[model samples]
Target: MKSKSNKSICKICGSDFARSGMTRHIKSCLGKHFKAKTKGKAKRLYYLHIYAFYNPDYFLHILISENARLEDLDNFLRDIWVECCGHMSSFMRPGQHQEIGMKNKINEIFEPGLTFSYMYDFGDTTELSIKNIEIFNGAIKSKKKIQLISRNSPPLVACDECNKNMAEIICAQCQWDGTGWLCKKCAKNHECGDEMFLPVVNSPRTGVCGYTGD
Candidate 1:
């Protein structure tokens, strides 16, 4: 009986069968072509940021798709930094080359948005290959520190009367004590009082008359 399935026969091989049989046969017959079209020929375009120099020298590459092999990365890097051929290194996308296994080859076919990288340890020149590879962002980020400059600790002046202690008091009449070191009563009497006593200029007296200039 006719299976009446959609698969009729292998068009290329010319074998007769049902619709399902024909479909399966066709797939088997063109397995290589399908694999090539889907895996090898298929390409995806992507953008890659390359850090070439020991410093932060970034180069941008736009491609229709990534090549499966890392060798492609080596060639691309060499072209970018022609001056440094063998010095450059290569890494793949999605994972850092250094972190991944070394034996992995880069020339394999790649899917879209795939990424790769190359580096130079600043070594001798040689025709570059997919050797030791490492990948890192060109810039490293860290928190910033703020520094405060103190105001010279406001010049600790000694007390004029009690030279043993720090002084912030100033004798108004003489202006000798810029910091105003006199006691509360002395400051009031010297500056506010009309009975100004000889301008508090003379050496500080031990008694009230001397300190307050009474």
Candidate 2:
């Protein structure tokens, strides 16, 4: 009798696959057949992750993916900010060039830093669709959400010890003083249990640290 624990090989390909990557691996060899079979398949849903920058009432976004089309992303952003116009553009690789002003081909791919501009039509809904594509946003994720930050914008936070306005993270160890900006080294020192990190009311005016009612 055959044991229930015995493994079986795929009928399509004489290879053993526990799970996961098997289907994806088979795609390359059977890609043509798979594409042909799915020619009339229902459309697959995709999400467009977009970042927009606004100033002087102008708006631009770095189109991150083609999974959704240029129009879809514009609609999403319009919902987020209703008073702006939208435009869309495609970027080519470092060594590539595109026509000065012309519609992109259906097979054209977008690259990082490729700019897209659109006029916000003051519409309540915006949507579009495109082929599957990928976007690389470089290695800095912390600054990802600061798309709207500008030189003239107000400071996000005021460091009580340093008395300086800071838009980003403040070192938990140092007092908010100019020197308290404590370079990254000093920042690490605090993380290591430096004395400055001890519980103390250093900034009474700012009320950064304190007891219940005093």
Best by lDDT: 1
Estimated TM-score for each candidate:
0.26, 0.23
Candidate 1's displacement at residue 34, Å, is 25
After superposing candidate 1 on the true structure, give the runs of residues whose Cα lies further than 4 Å from its correct spot. Answer: 1-42, 53-57, 82-85, 92-117, 121-214
203: Cα error in model 1, Å? 77
Model 2 TM-score? 0.23
Top-scoring candidate (TM-score): 1
lDDT, candidate 2, equals: 0.29
